[model samples]
Target: MHHTIEVEDLYFTYPDGREALRGVNLTVPPGVKMTLVGPNGAGKSTLMLHLNGILRGEGRVRVAGMEMNEENLPRIRAAVGMVFQNPDDQLFSLTVFDDVAFGPLHMGLPEADVLLRVETALRAVGMSEYRNRVSHHLSMGEKKRIAIATVLSMHPEILVLDEPSAGLDPRARRMLINLLKGLDMTMLISSHDMPLVAELAEQTAIMDNGQVVACGPTAQLLADHALLERHGLAP
Candidate 1:
């Protein structure tokens, strides 16, 4: 009965006077797979940042029952894995193994445990063979998988991904989808891919202009063409 992710009256404004989130209130119970659909500049990415306290705002944000603040930022980040929109941002190590081991090592795990986590995570994403590959030389799909392995190594209770399927070829996208379906943690995905949403999310939330406009069962919302159109999610 516990909520894995919670935001109450959350508001975020950039230093340059750009408001991204407006009183966003939502909760995802443990182990639920949810999709966030929104057009450009809808604050979906901003909201994801709030989950791990990357971009703090005005209101209560909690992950796995821990309040997100400076004192608990480290633990909160360890518990909530975020796969950013751009794989380049996540993979920066000279080799894929270093990138995947970065989080666990930073958390100060034993060297043996860190290596184990890196191997297990890479294997989970089916990228174990690329352990020694340089990230800068990897293809887009390989980088994406390596990015995911970096977070998976942390063993986060909740997984937040932004545009996970973006810029991938059909085969790569399908492989990513299959990898997601096999995961067993709470997932919050922000994507405009309706087909992926329909296949992966049990619940869907529609966002626009920094607020959640409508949320409910995925099938019901997908069936409502008018609602999708109203939110600029459909043609």
Candidate 2:
């Protein structure tokens, strides 16, 4: 079976000689919603950066059947939609419509097609009513949804998120969780929120010291208290 995302023997290091990923390997099958959980400095974010060619590292990273390379970056980025932990990082346009339309516009799509994509994406995130509103004025929950809408307009095959539940309150977190549950694309989310992981992921991979230490069904992994405790996921 073909994988939607594949990382094999990945290795990455910062300029200061700090290793962020070491021989990491992971795979996400098509249409799978998987979560990567681990303590701080586990290289989850580092690994995510490689998904869209934001941070080139030593290893074979493939997404939607395309290998990571300078020549393939444009196509690869179009295939993988990355949602950062901070919604602010993703939304910059004055209006929610423009923010969501940026990707399709850049793709040189027709005006009608761009409008359609923007509308479809906003509807998908349940933010269609806020299309004309200022992106920066919305609440955190609203912003998160809009951020996702911006990515959805690109029509990516894979959705990669980093710490999606990071600063959200309970209500916003719940909303975010529901929003994620409704997305049908392949997803690889890096989050510390175990409950969110349990709710959204069918599969889970535990990362530590820059490597994937374990991978299995969410229920099986979450049931392992000793493993969770050892990895600082549970007390």
Candidate 3:
């Protein structure tokens, strides 16, 4: 079985002495969409950081069969795309075109190819019309979409996202959902929105206290009212 992402007995601790992850074991198969549901301090973000070598942790971590180490970090980052919780954190360029094209441009691709990638990614996220608009002038929802496009332009195999629908209005939310539906790649999403999770993920993992308590089919996990209540996923 080939896994796009793999981890074995992973452990991570913050400099402030907070143990963010405790022996996390996870595997994301190629082309699978898995949502991670957990409380604020459950270490979901920490785990995601480990995927592309943003934060090196103890034990084994692998992406697309390559171990997560200094030597493999660059290739791992190219294979994995991460969209942060805040669009502002990810989008710093003056224009949408620049932000979306940043990754490909930095990779030494020809200018024509970089432009093509930027256009394709913008179209994929339904942001092609705003390609020349200033990033700071866009609405929250628009910024989010562009942030996604910026990463998508890299043509990564694994897409990791955190709170993708944080500030989207109803219409924008629907658009984002539809956009996600059209994507045919392995996705690791972390969000508090249960409805979105139901629509996007085929599988789900429940994490708490720095560990994954359970993982299985999305419907089965979400249907467990008692389990959800215990973990604060339900009220």
Candidate 4:
């Protein structure tokens, strides 16, 4: 019964002396899709950054049975794939194929293996036809899918997404939701989209003022309108 992720009394502060995370504690079991919901500045992104050692704070953070530290960073990062809110931030290569192949290539995988990973990842995201296309020229939705494929090519066991559905149109959002539902890895998604959260996550954790304030079943938490309103999730 090993947990996929664990955080204990995590605390972090920015260089400017602003505290981003305040003694946060969280745990995600393997194969669970959990949504992290909170008002702006609640430290959701900050917390997600710690999952793979992007932001090392004062606390214990573990992923895939490895502790968060400089020595374990490479392994931890390989195990935890992070997809940022903006697809542009994740996509930098010339073509979609290059962008998706970047991680596997960096891992020093063989040429054939990298090619296979790129193809498999693109097919998973329904972007196989866009492999040769320019990454910057695609639509937001297409770019988002490619961004996800970039991480998928790494063969991560856990997926951490930050505001994945932001700026998506109805159709794009729906498509993203479907794509996420199809991914079998453990996921911790940070988003304000309640409906998307409801559709994808079985468990939900609400963050506020740099800490997790509530956590429970998605249906149970979403049903508490007063709690949602208090956290700025509902009007």
TM-score for each candidate, following the candidate numbering: 0.97, 0.98, 0.98, 0.98
What residue runs in model 4 are displaced by over 4 Å at the alpha carbon?
Answer: none
110-214: candidate 1 lDDT, tens digit per residue: 999999999999999999999998999998888998999999999999999999999999999999999999999899999988899999999998889999888
lDDT of each: 0.92, 0.93, 0.91, 0.93
lDDT (Cα, tens digit) per residue for candidate 3, span 136-215: 99998899899999999999998999988888899888988898889999999999989999999999988898888889
Can you list the residue pairs that collide in candidate 3?
none
Clashes of each: 0, 0, 0, 0
Write the residue-wise lDDT of candidate 4 on 156-204 in tens digits: 9999999999999999999999999998889999999989999999999
Show the lowest summed lDDT stretch of 10 residues, model 2. Answer: 226-235
Flag clash pairs in model 1. none
Deviation in angstroms for 169 in model 4?
0.9
RMSD of 3: 1.0
TM-score of candidate 4 to 2 decimals: 0.98
Displacement of residue 183 (Cα, Å) in model 3 is: 0.4
Ranking by lDDT: 4, 2, 1, 3
